[model samples]
Target chain A: MSDLLTIENLKTYFFKKKKVIPAVDGVDLKIKKGETIALVGESGCGKSLTSLSIMRLVPKPGGEIVEGKVNLDGVDLTKLTENEMCKVRGRDVSMIFQEPMTSLNPVLTIGEQLIEVIINHQKVSRPKAREKSIELLKIVGFSRAEEIMKDFPHRLSGGMRQRVMIAIALSCNPKLLIADEPTTALDVTIQAQILELMKGLTKEFDTSILLITHDLGVVSELAERVVVMYGGQVVEEAPIDSILNNPYHPYTDGLIQSVPSLTGEIKELHTIKGNVPSPDQFPKGCRFAPRCHKAFDRCFNEHPDLKAISDSCSVRCFLYEDKQEEEEYNV
Target chain B: MSKVLEKEILEKESAGEPKQEILRVTDLKKYFPIKSGVLQKTVGHIKAVDGISFSINKGETLGIVGESGCGKSTAGRTIIRLEEPTEGKILFKGKDISHMKEKELRKQVRREIQMIFQDPYASLNPRKTLGSTIVEPLNEYNLYGNQKQRLERVGELLETVGLDSSYSNRYPHEFSGGQRQRIGIARTLALDPEVIIADEAVSALDVSIQAQVINLMQRLQEEFELTYMFISHDLSVVRHISDKVAVMYLGKIMEIADKNSLYEEPMHPYTQALLSAVPVPKKHGATQRERITLKGDIPNPANPPKGCVFCTRCPAAMDICREVQPILKTKKENHSVACHLFE
Candidate 1:
């Protein structure tokens, strides 16, 4: 499969008068066509910045994508002009924010918002746009798409508003959807409904998804592959199952055990010691070494590059750095 | 009022129910008035906590789980008299304290019942040091020793909540999310509250830190013999923390059962959908994880479905479920469900 979205050595930094905060430091990720990739970490780990950088929507004045290239379907989004990027935003790549109720314009009706996006992207008449909006809402599993379109955002329930958001995002038929904690604000039951709806609709449209969330359980449910980010960098990247059951990076392993699950027999949860360091205070060597249980002498003094363990999996840890040790551990 | 914990009381019939039921809520209701026009006349009310009844046995955690606007938080607040109930009775240790005057509540119910809020940073006093924050509560109750002794007690409380006694000197901003949460727990523990109402206490922390706090909470519960009303929307967390779980919707409980029975054999359709909705860490079947994803959002609490609060979204919702409201009735030995399907 061709790469739908490719991010190379992406470095986004927040500039202050005296110091520069490298929120997303030397990150790399790739999402293939029709694949779902989950980027996960604790707060301040820079997962959000990576998504913002891809969309060329990083907040201005302080934050900027200092170094890196983001290519979506052979087109470098980083090289696109401001005006041209506007055209591509909804037509080629769309984003669904964490909170739908707030993200949706409170002043506008659901139909008006949906119609505006559809007409702006597609060469459709006003009536045609309205019809397309209704169709999009139906695809998102809305029972009364017609009624929902006439209603204002506040009139609908949280789940309904989220579905409407998805409907608007899908109106343009974008190849890739960037969903940042789409269901975080909804209930578990509603979350499941939304997740299932997104999965089915995206599959129908053959659109790849870049899912950014904190919940390990949600990541396990939706994403085909996983990229474990820490200190604004990708620590490990692998297929979802491989990352879940046998993560090589100590951070990923600790993270998996950290999430209390239903299946595990373990009594006490294994805690990763210490909080994620702020961008400015990140450790000198391996950023995770300060809190890593398996940190060795070299781990404290030097950083390890992301190394491939298998054809599709990789880890950034010195424990997997030595060729002989890597083979032994792999065996 | 409450047919609550009768089974648990009977099970411990020989040992004579260790630690007589600390808190019992019988048919509690808390409604926020919605006024309209310049007159500010009563238009309608958002039935935030519509008639709900449950009890917490001494030395046990009773988790109330639900989605947002489901009244889980409202239930917790109402129980502690933070948001006074519009109707129903609150019996803490078999005494009706539901309608107690604010002054009387402060004197009697206040010290015994303490709350741990969701946002640790917001809950803590930014202007106050960790020592003073915890000590402030102690000072209010005229707790243990004098000036020097209070400082010593503050240090002890800090240690009990798994923070270094030295952290008492640090400000709230200096501590991480987990540490701040620890400080909040320390404040909750400082009063020697027999029952702690933790409202989404660990929901804000990262998974690893959340685990640490949970473990700390479980440890503290055993040490202090604390009865917890753990409120959260996270199913997995509640499953791990609670001894008996009450699933609430639109301010009314859908089901209540012992942890094992509820997780293993969920009887209510709402419960069934809820359990299946929780995504497993590893794919057990991988391909065939049958999820009962409910349709639509939770109905408006102000104008809830006439029959059942959950009737609007229930998959197996019948005509009766749309007409006659079903009250919670016993199903199995220790399980109860409020659903027409159960009937």
Candidate 2:
């Protein structure tokens, strides 16, 4: 599979009150064609910022992509003009936000929203766009597509609103879909439906997905690859099975152990000590060392760079230092 | 609601077992009236909690698991009398206090039952110091002795929840989400309440922080011999902390059983579907779990299905399920399911 979107040394910084906060510092990611990669982290870990930076939608005045190349196909997005980037956004790649309620406009009907996106990217007649809108609604699992088109966003449930968001994102038939906490606000049953729908739609449309979530369960269900982020850096990246079963990073291990399982005997849950530090207050050394149980003297003073342990696995920790390769793995 | 069930519980308690019922709720219902038009006349009632019954033994956690608007929160509030129950009996230590006067409640039931709110940020006063916020409860009940003793008690309470006693002087804004929640727990514990009704207590926290708080709660439950009515939408966390679990939908419990029975062999179709829908992060081949996707959203609580509340989306809903409401009945030892299929 060819790489659809590649981000190299991505750093999104927030300049607040004359202080530069490294919100997303030095992230490297590659999404293969028709593949799904999950960016997993706690709050303030810059997972959302990474996705925002990719779409060039990081809130301005304070936030900016300080450095990096967001290469989609052959074009470097960072070098593109504002006008050029606007055209590239919905046509080449689209995004789905966490809260479907706020993301959608209440005044507009579902049909209006869907058609607007379709006509915005593709030069199509209103009637044709409306026809395509209903089709998109049907594709997202709406049985009464015609009625739903006329209904406002407020009339639908959380699950239905998310489906509408998915429909609009897919209306352009973009090569890649970036869903940021797509099902976080939904109930588990609704989340399951959405996940199932996304899986089916991915296979059908052959669209690669950059799924941003704090949920390991959601990642296990949809993503083939997992990128574990902590304090604005990719601490670990590996295949889903390896990440779940045998994580290289101590943070990853602690995270997997923390979540109480549905099937297992009720045991005392393992906890990563302390809270996730604010982006500005992030430690100078390895970001996770403060909370890490296995931190050593070296882990407290020096930052460990992301080093590949194998062809498919990479980790950022002094514990895995002996196994790390001298050369970086090629995407 | 059955005499037989009450007798069985009492008989078990008398027959050498020390399982004394701390709280028992029978046919609890809370209806919020919806009035419209110029006259503001009585129009309809949003049946937020409609006839839910359960009992919690002394020092055991009874977890109430349900989706939003399923009346789980309302049920908890009504039990604690935060919200007045429209119709039902709330028995604390085998005495019905559902219609008790506010003054009497403060003197009797209020001191024994405390509630920990979900949003740690909204629940506490931003302007107040952590000491004052916790000590306010002590002041209300006229607990401890002088100002010095109260402040000392406040410091002790903070230390109990794993926060430094020195943090009592700090404001709520100075603490993180987890730290703020610990403060909230401290406030709840200041009264030395026997039953703590925690509503979505850990839902707002990150996974790691959530585990820390959960562990803290467990340790406190043991230390204080505290009975908990832990209400949350998160099934896994509920299963982990609860001795018995109740699954609610559309203002009624679909199933109530031991965590093992409910999680492993859920009798109600709704319970089964809800469990299956939860995505588990397990090793490959460890989970070949069949997901039961329920159709449509929860029916409007104001006008829930005339038949079964869950009939609208129940995957295995029968013809009878559409015409008649299923009453909750014990189908097995210590397991109760409210589905017609069990009959």
Candidate 3:
């Protein structure tokens, strides 16, 4: 089956003064129908920018999607006009942000906000939209859906607000759902609840999700496939099980090891040596080579392509690159 | 001003290990008042921390884990007297320092207990250099010798936190989040504190950086013989750094036990749900962690449920759970729970 959303060489850049800093440099990803693909990376790794690029919501003036093809449901979003893109955004792809408090309107009641989305996307009356909004609220796991419709966003807890945000996002029933760190601001229990709700909703609607987060635990639990982003590029992409158990990329390994386990005896956490290079200061060759433990001479001078290491795994590391391709490198 | 407390502090001055109980709290409560209308009449209160009791031993890390708005942060802040307690007692070295005056507390107790805030970006003054930030505490406490000695101490502190001494001249903005957290730790350690309360300290950092900070904190704890109240919502982090753990829900502790006991055999339904909810990055694939997705949101602190705070959401809640508050009591060796299930 063709992908619900396909991103090819997506590059989102920030223009500061005369310099252009690549935030989401040359990245490729494909999410099929009903697939939950997580974009895992630390802050400034361009995961958030990539999501913004897909939604065509990159901040104007300085930030822009400099280069990329964001193909959504057989149509390229990049080629769409402003008015055309606006129509496709909520109806084809909706987003859930990290902080629900700021994401939602403070003055408006929950029902007003949800109904607005419903009416804007679907050909429904105010009464029909109201009914649809209430249905969404209940679907997102609210028991007293009618009561919540009357409540303002501020009256609800962080978890409830996030749930409402999810409900609103699902109200349009977009083919693709971009949840960028939707649970980061929430507590673990609340995070679990939100992730479960998201998964359940996706199953019901047959929607694809691009779950962006820095936490691996969240990715492991919620996403089926994981794309490890580092220095504004994908370092590895594989099944969730493969990424957690046998991550090939040094950065992926570092992320996996750095996370202190909760299952058994606690061990001294292993840390990646240095900081993630600032966007402007990204290295000439491999972006992660500066901090990577096993970087050889080749890593400092040449960038490894995002090559397939196995059937279901793709890693961008010189160590896993085919030996037959080594003849093209240093003698 | 209690004679027993005075004697206890004196005894604790020369106190050794095996004589645990570095800090103890008895029936601690903190409530923020809600006011209404013209005259600003008191309209109820937000019971941030309600009648909580716990203890920490010297050189031990007591972790308090909970969801947002559950009062874990409030409890930590209240311990350092950052927020005035509405009621109850906090005994440091057997001294009830909760009611101590600011001036006296600063002299006698404040230095002994320090706090590392969650946002290192917000905690440090952006205008001040890292050197000055670390030295500010020294100046306040009047520690170290002359100007040269103080500057040297600051440099040494910078090196101890794994940052180069040369970076001391740089402002807080010049450092990364992890480095800034280290700077925060250095400032907290400046006064040679006995108990350090870190409230979501590492929650802001990246995974790899968080590890560095956690490892650094663990090493420093050993070197300084520091007792830590590591308050965080991340169970994995708390499990890694803590000797004992307390699971709190809406203004009250549902369970408290040694780290192994708490994680291994969580008795309270709330604790079990909380633990189950945490996405453990272990035994992936088919061996999925059993999850208990609780329904509804946490009740507002001002108007908690009639009986137990968790009764509204607990999966194992019984009829008694809705009518009577459960006291946190020991059920096993060093393991305690506040649930009707055990009874």
lDDT of 3 at B300: 84
CA deviation > 4 Å runs, candidate 3: A323-331, B1-19, B282-286
Model 1 lDDT tens row, A1-331: 8999889999999999989999999998898989999999999999988999988899998998888899998899999999999998988999999998799999999999999998888898999999989888888887788998899999888888888889888888899999999988888888898888878965788899999999888898889999999999899999998888788899999988877765334567789987889899988889999999999899899988987877888888888767636665878
For all candidates in order, the CA lDDT equals: 0.88, 0.93, 0.89
Residue-wise lDDT of candidate 2 within B102-143, one digit each (tens)?
999999998899999999899999999998988998888787
TM-score of each: 0.94, 0.96, 0.96
Query: Which of 2 and 3 is ahead in lDDT?
Result: 2
Q: Model 3 residue B201 lDDT?
A: 95
- DockQ leaderboard ranking: 2, 3, 1
User: Mind giving the per-residue lDDT tens digits that candidate 3 earns over A153-219?
Assistant: 9898899999999999988888999999998888777888888888787778999999998888888
Q: Quote the chain B TM-score of every prediction.
A: 0.94, 0.95, 0.95
Residue pairs that clash (backbone atoms under 3 angstroms), model 1: none
Best by DockQ: 2
lDDT of 2 at B163: 92
Off by over 4 Å in 2: A325-331, B1-16
